[model samples]
Target: MKEQLVFATNNPHKIEEIRRQLGDRYTFRSLQDIGCTEDIPETETTLEGNARLKARHVKSNYGQDCFSEDSGLEVAALGNAPGVDTAHYAGPQRDAEENNTKLLSELGDRKDRLARFRTVICLIQGDTETLFEGVCEGRIATSPVGHGGFGYDPVFVPTEGDGRTFAQMKQDEKVRISHRGRAIAKLQEYLKSRSGADRPTG
Candidate 1:
């Protein structure tokens, strides 16, 4: 029997991305899979706190080995103003287009458009709690370029990528160099080290 691991998220896009990246090494469960229809509050002021908050909540409620990830975009020019508030940058509505428009306006015609995407993943199982982080250095594009990814993907161009927004790339290509992708790679490494396996079994 495959070991079950609960991924703390209700977003179908994120679920799909995680599933695609992790493959079939273990049986993955989402919030909906276990009937958790409520919103996991991300009230923390930082990414790590939010990730841990969700992970601990799920483990406490469902008593399962689970993990949660928080991601954000930080612009250098804005002194990372939207570091943790990237989701609701515009207002409480958290509209993606409004957020994008706000970001562009704030960064209007700036020569230094440097920015980066950061992700933090918190894993909790039994009494063990571990945190993994990943950073993707890139710059903000002048406008939303593609319609592929979620959040700030439309206006973010990775330094390592071929001058295209993450939203313009394929899922495989995006995950290969994305902050979430890198953080997940670290998670996989840590799990492999803990279990001496190729991929995470649970």
Candidate 2:
């Protein structure tokens, strides 16, 4: 039987992306799957901190092997203004279109559009906590492009691609080089070393 791996998230896009990358390595569970109906607070000021916060919450309440990820877009020209606050860059509403507009307005005529997406994943099992990080260097597009991804995908162009925004690429193409994918890859490596890293070590 596949081991239960609690994936602490309510976002279906993220859950699907991660599940695809994870393959058949383990059985995945999410917030809805586990009846965690409330919006978990992410009161931290940093990506890693928020990731840990979510993971810790799941472990405390569910007593299960769980993991959480936090990611953001860092634009070099804006001094990384939206690092940890990428999700709420527009305001507390966390509207994606507004956030994108706000980012574009802040980046008006900056000339240097270089940026990157960074993701941090925190995994918890019992008292053990582990962190994995990944970064995908890229540039912010002049405008949103494509219709494939969520969040900043419409405006982010990875360095490994042919100048198309992340939203322009297929899921398989994007996951192979995404920051989240890279971070999860590291976690998978660690999991492999620790007996395939799944819950119910039963």
- Tell me, by lDDT, which candidate is best: 1
Clash count for each candidate, listed in order shown: 0, 0
For candidate 1, write residues 1-202 as lDDT tens digits: 6657789998788888888887788788998898888888889999999999999988888887899999989999999879889889999898999999999999999999999999999999789999999999999999999999899999999999999999999999999999999999998888768767555669
Task: Tell me the spans in candidate 2 whose CA falls farther than 4 Å from its real position.
Answer: 196-202
Query: Cα miss at 102, model 1 (Å)?
Result: 0.9
In the range 1-202, model 2's lDDT, one tens digit per residue, is 7768888898889889888998886888898898888898889989999999999988888777799999989999988879999888999998988999899889987789999999999999778899999999999888899988999899999999998999999999999999999999998888887884554676
User: TM-score of the candidate numbered 1?
Assistant: 0.93
Q: Candidate 1, overall lDDT?
A: 0.91
RMSD of each: 2.9, 2.7
